[model samples]
Target chain A: MGIHLPSLLPQMQELGQALYERSLQVSAMIPKAIKALHSTAELDHSNLQSKIKKAGNRWTGAIPTEETLNLTYPPPTVPQSLHVIGADGSQIYPDRHAAAFYYLINIGSIVVSHGSGKAPTIQQESQLFFELEDLYDEADHPVQNAYVNLRRDVAEMKTLTKIAESLAGEQTLAILDNSLLLWMALQTGGSTSRETDRTLQQYLKLLDRLRSSKTGLAGFIDRPRSVSVLALIHLAGLPDDQINQETLRLTPFRGLTDRAIFTKLLAPGHRSALFISASPLNRDFRTAGHEVHFFYLNTDADGAVVRVEIPIWVAQDPELLNRVHAGILKDCQTTGGFPYTLVRAHELAVIPPQERAALEDMLQRTLLGHGLRPTQSQKALTKQLTGQRKQHTL
Target chain B: MPESPMMIGRVTRCSTRGFVGAMQISENALPVFGSLCQAEAQGGRSYVVGLVYDISITDDQFARQLAALEEVPQEQIADGQINRHVPVEFSALAVGFHNDGGFHQALPPQPPLTLASVFSMVSKDSVDFTSQLHFLQTILNAPQLPVDELLTTALRLSAQARPEEERERFLLQAGREVAHLLPQDLTRLENILRGLRA
Candidate 1:
């Protein structure tokens, strides 16, 4: 039986009250800190860079700032002729209790041609994995959904690269609605998934293809809660040695988000200064000439800050950067402050839970057709029997 | 050449009574309020012909706001309408059918199946279906439907379907059928006659 939520009303209210109080306190705390920074926090790029070099062995994720303490650009007007493509992926994880250990990934993508007045090309492709190679890593352990999802992301980029190649002109941008740092999930310090390394190589290869074709690639993370900006705040708050992880926990900006701080610093339609993320995952990109750098843009009111990440190629080139900015801003206008292509792509890609259930039914029917009896594990059967469903059956 | 957008919808629901069924349509320019729709039964062997009587625009708070929306620029209107799916459940009359290349004015053997392709049979095809006014009984009884509108359009199409010599005769027969069906609503009947005469 589930614990009764009504029974814990008093405790829930107490917790809610505490959180609400803390939020108010944080709200007050953040604006004051940002105001102080506006007056005193130098862009301090050189000092921050030297300190970063000094603390290389100790710290991992402080991003290097551009010239200004921050940079915010007004909303860029979209060019007359352009092509915007976006891809999103969703997956049904392999159920251990199913007939076979299998997973499925569905990628949905759209290509919107601006100034052509044509309906966007929307497509969804679903791939099923049941082979041994798909089920296991190089080290032979059964792969989890996380690894499969990363592979799906790689597949999406590969699809984008192919699409970009075919389009060839009119200034294109291919977007993924997630972080560019695919290696973040694979970096567990001691163990590196060789499969991930292979995927990374392929991902970077696609980045090169995209770059050669002049197709801008970006990862758009909306309403991001990242504290990448906190590193700068930490640098400003304490000395190099004092700015270690343990000391960072004690800083006043502990629970504050970069979004929260930037909300005050930036007006709507403005982006912050670029910062090269120093995460271990970003290091590989740096070596491969595609380092991941991010800048926060406030797309709408009520402090909506979306973090946009680009490879070093786009970041280093001003025209490409403007295209990325203008392209995204116009697309946002189409969707009321979100990427319209990404919205359509996600709608095409997301596999509903009912579809997964239907797939299982099909799998059972296929097995029965082959005269090979396949049954769910007893534990799975038991869970199904005991589960409460919003449906009727015998 | 493609003669007008080939309108296609899916059968959302159907009824055993053969009087009414609902088809869900999403088109930028929806089927005219009173039009003919046809559904192919399972295979290509049989078909169910229907009259489009009611168009229900699906609603929620969002759709309400959209409906209340005022003069938007022409370009924005084109893109904005993409989000306004507005699935129309046009209540239809199971008027007649064609089986094995033979046409019959009668109820469908069965209601259209769900998710079956529902095509808006237009132009001469619509004119051919309403050649007989037998479907008017169901149309008249459906109070929710616009009885006057359907009678007028159906008679007009049936008249157009005839040869020039028989056009007057077709309207006379359809008028008699309407007068017989609604003796009490004579004003409405007269209005329908005015529409058919036009």
Candidate 2:
């Protein structure tokens, strides 16, 4: 009664067929993309930048580095003894209909010492925001979810940096379970520009500290939907005069991701050439000397290609870059496709639904014990009562 | 006197006849099967003494997948065993209660509350509790338990709790109790008594 299953069947079948057709198209485009990558390997960086700028700052794509476009580096020599620290975060967003008006962020991290033959060290840090200043902004409105997510990202990065600093002399690589670029903070239109800028500043400052500590940092993105490389390939096939906003907007290879091309190109345990992200926000990151550079890595023989984003510092240092590449590849091999530390970190950070409910119950009880009445909105109560029962035809 | 009780786990579920506790997956020196343990109940006014009958470690989808791999690194194995949240659960059968500073060979008035601390009984306490073998009947009649093997293991552990010279005598007394508890079932009685030797 809730979903009208019979009515969904037709649409579901159509969706399946459409997906099949799209996959065929994507498969066909893979070779073209590869061809474009090879042909443009010698394309001058300045020429590509001029074309990107001439697109009226509308075209965002991968900006090629000195590395050839189609180059695939085999798994680098991973150090015999290395430390890979992964940090992930989970947050409970504030809900207006809930019994409380607050948010909670939990950052979980793991330090895996390869070849040490010892158990990995794991930690979790949780913080609750309930104070008036934390809950509301200067506009007297509750903080947005984007702001909470930004804070969670900051917390995760800070925890990683803290861990890495503690092992300053050791060969350590800190990995984040997200993109290194803080584009979400910059793109969230609802949040105040000043707040967004401040959060970005904090993130950049953390990167500075990490660089100073000489820690290798990377952001691992699984099954990335990014089309940065595909956008670049699209530009490769276009003439200089045709590289305008209208032409860039109507990409011939729409819905195609960089992963598909790399999956066909890179062998197992190999990585594509590194390129800097063309996001306008990266300009600010560039100003801060922490521009985000990324590459596609074939993590496994089954063609599991993931995007690995690193800072300019890591990309500039060959030794550090190799550590990031080899460490992540080795970590992926252990878990069958994804980094083990990131999976463990996510497991530690995730707050299950039952736990969230229990936390709410504890909060409510504490409030009542303190002579304060805590109650959920009527809407929330009705949903809870009905949601637990099976839907009836009547 | 007992030296000291080592807290092993916390009571997660309980009843008048038994209770279950969850231990850390990476807990070292886990209590062996048929080991004697106790849970504080009635706000520590009474202690429900139980014999550990079963200890199990459950695996999730992640662990099952990892196990299928040809090799897993030490870091990953450690992450799975120590960092992952899978619990090592154990079930204990209630056999007696310690109330008024005396051991009673009967179930307590109430089971321990959830989250009550459960501790392993020290050797002295184990010896004192099994001095009288009336708890054998409780073990034999408890549902969903390996009755014969449990009696054998519990009797052997209890016998070991006694002094070296007195172990045979203690097991002899326990064997007699098990025989009396299963009089009509000659095979079951023989099977239990056959395993009661120190």
Candidate 3:
């Protein structure tokens, strides 16, 4: 049966009211979060790191750097000849009922040469996985969606690195439409999975290549829900002795996100102080000299806050960081708020429903050419017939 | 000597009456209005020929949003113009077909298939196609198109394709064909003839 809007009205009204009230509470907690930030701004970096480590807190938070917690830096002048490369990826997971069982990952990238007043170079690469080893796990079952996502993430990073290495002479900044941390593998089966370890190694190798190329890399997360910095603020509010697992499991500012606080703290075209991600996966990245650091930027005057994650090298070099800041700001100004290169990259990578159907049709034709009759599973055919919307007879 | 055919675009939508082809934009130029174009049909055995009647460059929400911005970077404008898949579509009125090494001033037996390459007819081919002047009836009777203006433009282009000495004579012959086709509509014939003169 179709959803009845009239029947859902009362519950929707309740939901709206609850959300409104929660927003108010979140707003009230912002000032408290800010106060906590200022109160602990002067704490030494080593001390903060030791506090977070010794607390054995279950929550992942940000470890403060040398900069004060509340510091906001204005956008620096963009260099005259800057090359910005934005890479994004999309995927189609394997379907059990289709003519074939395979997943596809397409990575799209755009390289814009600033100050040249020329069109950007666009490229896309797609890979299809259908081998038994790719489709099945050690248990010989179909892989989950998480596995497909992990592959896509790895593809994007590899594509970015490959493109960056190709453009050797220019001052290049590589941007991915995600966090730099390769944490998706954790979702596949936790960090201990053999698959997770292999994926992490692959990513570290790519990160090493990017660093060696001296191509600054940044990951742009739009409207990010990360509360790493907020968790830091929460940790600051607690005394040293009370830092137990129970307190870390819950926060008074439950509904609040980090963007909520940074949106208020950062002015237009400014970025907050960098913080080191305290997640366990980041520790692996740190040991490899490519530690992930993040800062929140107000992309525009209307308060579009986006979290930018970079490696230790880019964060350490002032000029590289400013290029990232200014190049992203200028790209955002092209579109209203979001970076245009990333938008174009997504447009290049996305596979809509029609294209997927066309791909299946082509596969069927290919099978037919080889004297094989391609057929969908009975269950899939039935769904195609009955899954359509019901026509109303007036 | 025959001039080399210039590729206009590929046929996106096709029918016996007419076909719509997207213009292959280069150097920011479009196919001239009322120019002759040809697309192959029936497995290359037949060629459906048409006249360019309308050229349109469509705008989407993305372009409109970019335009609404206070300032758009040159690279962005270039990207939108160069990289975006949205093409400039142009409509053509099918007037004739070529088969068995002869030009027939009528619709083809079958419409061109989707993605059939369309090209501007070489000067010698245009001259040969218009030599009979029988295609004027097809353009003059297309009520859905701007008939009078299209006829005038097509005639002018056809006349230009001929030798300088035979240009006026060719136009006069086209004028007569148009007059014969519209015997009763004196005002319309006058407008077409007047347009041809201009």
- Cα deviation of B60, candidate 3, in Å: 2.5
Collision pairs in model 3: none
Cα lDDT tens digits, model 3, A1-394, are: 6689999999999999999999999989999888888877867667677678766735589888877889999999988888889889999889889888999999999998888899999998988998998888767768888888988999999989998999877788889999998878778864336766787899989999998888879999999998888889788777777888888767887888999999989999999999999887887899999999999999988999999999999999998899889989988886766989899999999998998889889999999999999989999999898889688898
Query: TM-score: which candidate is best?
Result: 2
TM-score of 1: 0.88
* Model 2 steric clash pairs: none
Per DockQ, the best of the predicted structures is 3
> What do the candidate models score in CA lDDT, each in turn?
0.74, 0.88, 0.87
Can you write out model 2's per-residue Cα lDDT over A1-394, one digit (the tens) per residue? 2788999999999999999999999888778777887877767778877766676665678988888878899999999999999999999999989888999999999999999978899999999999987777667788888888988999999999999999999999999999998867865455456777888899999999999999999999999999988788778767888877778877777878888888889899999999999898888889999999998999888899999999999999999999999999888886767998998899999999998889999999989999999989999999999888975696
By summed lDDT, the worst window of 10 consecutive residues in model 1 chain B runs over B71-80
Give candidate 2's error at residue A43 in angstroms.
4.1
Task: Write candidate 1's Cα lDDT for A257-353 as tens digits.
Answer: 7888888888878888787787777878888889998888877655568999999999888878888888887677535468877877887888877
Query: Candidate order by TM-score, highest to lowest?
Result: 2, 3, 1
DockQ each candidate and list the results: 0.24, 0.72, 0.76
